[model samples]
Target: MIHLERVNGDTIWDILKLTVADHQKNFVAGNDVSIIEAYIAITSNGYAFPFGIFEDDTPVGFVMIGYDKDEYWKDAPAIADGNYNLWRLMIDKAHQNKGYGRQAVELALRFIRSKHHFPLTM
Candidate 1:
């Protein structure tokens, strides 16, 4: 079964060993520290989140969610209020077609709802 879990600095660091070194579109390329830094930034702000999508406890993708357009912008009338936005989501190419992506996304949504501490769901 696939699962979604919150990412800490340690887990993010560990995943670097597997997230590939050539992905640059959304991930930091060439170095793992870039990933660590990105997650750290997210956690530090209290307004963003990142989740590790795991299949049978093994990581397969990264899903980033965050509260939108804060003070910098009017926080546009999102998909809905009290709902965060998915900033970037990527499944490791190796794991893309094995039905894990669907499971991973479902897992991510669950994690996000839990993180928000909301009893209501989508």
Candidate 2:
């Protein structure tokens, strides 16, 4: 029953507590940082939708999707325009290798399609 839950006051702490493996530390940013960036994007009139990947009541990971009109993307390549980026996706070290990552991505794509009415590319 893996699904995406919108990150909010009630679930922020749990989501922030999730972490990747030590070897992956350099690759994925902490959930706290992701949340902060999402905040910045929203305040800057951009779109950042952060979500907690959960299985039933347990929080397993975090994922975020962003639309490209933000000031941060002004200098980004043309491919960024009118496109949705799978900004962040990370499963806690304990939750890795359980296929949750793949499932979470599928859920994210469905979410994006439902919200934006556009097919996500890449």
Candidate 3:
């Protein structure tokens, strides 16, 4: 069963070990970087939720969601004023092309919806 697990001390190493394909390395940031960004965001008074994508007991990928009004996206664009952004989504190279990415996205969306009570744009 594919599900999302909170990225904590117990699971941080497993999430950090996940990586994308060589061709995708340029596009996706490493899990370590994402986790660092999450920490920064949280410390800056922004909302950041980082999760490990898992299939049963095995870690398969990572996803992060962020919500900020003026701290992170103040000058970016009008659409990002107060929306829940999918900051990161990464499936390890070995776990690619198996529908885990899609399932993980759906799970992330569901998670975002569950946390916020307002209308979501994405």
In lDDT terms, which candidate is top?
2
Query: Could you give the candidate ranking by lDDT, starting with the highest?
Result: 2, 3, 1
Question: In model 1, which runs have C-alpha deviations exceeding 4 angstroms?
Answer: 20-46, 71-82, 114-122
- Summarize candidate 1's per-residue lDDT along 12-75 as a digit string, tens digits: 7545545533554455332244355355544554355566777776787776666544443344
Q: What is the lDDT of every predicted structure here? A: 0.59, 0.89, 0.86
Tens digits of per-residue lDDT for model 3 on 62-88?
Answer: 999887543654565666557788889
TM-score of 2: 0.91
TM-score for each candidate, following the candidate numbering:
0.60, 0.91, 0.89
Model 2 pairs whose backbones collide: none
Model 2 segments more than 4 A misplaced: 117-122
Best by TM-score: 2
Number of clashes in every candidate structure?
0, 0, 0
Residue 71, model 3: lDDT of 64
Using TM-score as the yardstick, the better of models 2 and 3 is 2
Question: Tens digit of lDDT per residue, candidate 2, span 1-122?
Answer: 99899999999999999999999999988999999989998889788899999999999999999987777655666776878889899999999999999999999999777774543323
